[model samples]
Target: MSTYLPVSGWCYMTNDLMKEIIRVAVEAGERIMKIYEGDIRIEHKEDSSPLTEADRRSHEHIVSELKKITPEIPVLSEESADISWQKRKSWGKYWLVDPLDGTKEFIKKNGEFTVNIALIKENALAAGVVVIPAQKLIYRADINNGAFRRNYDGAETKLTADNNLNTDNLKIVGSRSHQSELMQTFVSNFENYEIVAAGSSLKFCLLAEGKADVYPRFGPTSEWDTAAGQCVLECAGGVVLDNAGNKLQYNTKDSVLNPYFIGMREYNEAVLSWFKALN
Candidate 1:
């Protein structure tokens, strides 16, 4: 029920949208910053993780402002918009967003939380934008068009993935705040690699910007969690593939839980075969 548009050049339009979207994301980040610094109360989600007023405020701002920017575009955000299976099945294109990622890190006051916004067209993520509120840094991408990193005070620089992961020279970036056992097992299988920890969607940024080389996730993740970051990484010449060595697709499953996947900087015959064996 959806149509695929040729992935052609559309930099001007995408950048314009990014400018507007950046405005909203930065504003929402400011809103969250205020709560983070003030005497705001932190609650827990139904799953019993820490949820603060900052999360709610940021979510509200992102959803309301994004709707104003693109009214026709449907949104699938972490805090809001739980689309039914029937309804989601009909969405050819949509905005897959997470206003406040790393709420636990936000609660920890480590200043690692980020605001994630992504555009999903067809089954793939078309664009990814990540803003670090405390640092005022931004990571953005529109594949074929380009991907770059910038900060409030810094100039933009192009992002590119490094093909330097081969045994001893390997670098593995794990969840900053949450690492699972399966992930550790998978990483241990590698002959030689240094492991790094990062929070929120920043792990994807590290891979995209060439800071880290590989990311393995054998635990549970949702569609909204990985959509934006995956787009950015893919644009930067990285790949986010499932067990079958295929890129993950959205809205096709009844449950939004993502299967195990690995994000790597470029393709490697050895690693690909290794993962296929793990499959």
Candidate 2:
């Protein structure tokens, strides 16, 4: 609903939206870890998704801080995003966020939950930040600039991937929590790739870090679920596309549920052709 990215306040690249997002998430994580440390009851939404007080706390904290820090930019958060397509279609730039990305892991107390934040422009994810609240680690990227991981030692390391990421052992990324039979068949179909399982938005982080190559998701996912991760993944030299091999767009469709998709590193015509053949 806004066109202020060009004339906006913060310089997205140098301004460190990553830092801001991480800061907010870490602050929210403080609250989440508090409840998580206790015997808090986890509730389930209508879709049977596990919900908890941590989710609401994180959502409220993220939304409040994002609005105050980057008030000029429109935001779509998984918890409170309801802007109509008519209004969002007019937007050239907006923030796509998932305040609590892994509620299931939160319920499972596996410490795999994360915070996801991304900026979108012209249907492309421009920048993203993913933070694991439990471990207090972060991975961030601004498109074409570079991707970075901030470990527990507070050291920031730049991420790099070999050009032949798809060639070697052929790392395949799949959801650590939820996996479908079809998804398994798809992975089983690939003889050259080694399958690896991960949870939450961290699957995309694996692709971003060159730890994995291909991520195929057959189940339903919301736009907020993948937007932030896709930004970091693509920035780190990867591609996340629908079965049609098209870049995923946010807020353009009436249903927020995303179709099946794949995440591949060093993408090219051959990979695109393979994806096309699957469709």
Per-residue C-alpha lDDT of model 1 across residues 1-279, encoded as one tens digit per residue: 122222234332255577777777888899999988878687887878677888788889888877777777788888875678898878877788888898878888888889999887777777788999999999888765667889976899988885666766778887655557566666767777787888888888899888888877766788888988888888888899988888988888788888888888776766665656655
- The best candidate by lDDT is 1
Best by TM-score: 1
Tens digits of per-residue lDDT for model 2 on 1-279?
Answer: 211223343326445555566777778778889998999787888778888888899889888887877777788888876788878888888888888898888877888888888878777777788888888888888875778889646888887653575453678776655567666656555567776877889888888888888787777799999987887787777878888878877777777888888887777566556555655
CA-only RMSD, every prediction: 4.4, 3.6
For all predicted structures, in order, the TM-scores are 0.90, 0.88
- Candidate 1 runs further than 4 Å off: 1-13, 175-179, 276-279
C-alpha lDDT values of all predictions: 0.79, 0.77
Off by over 4 Å in 2: 1-11, 166-168, 175-179, 268-274
Worst 10 residues of 1 by lDDT: 1-10
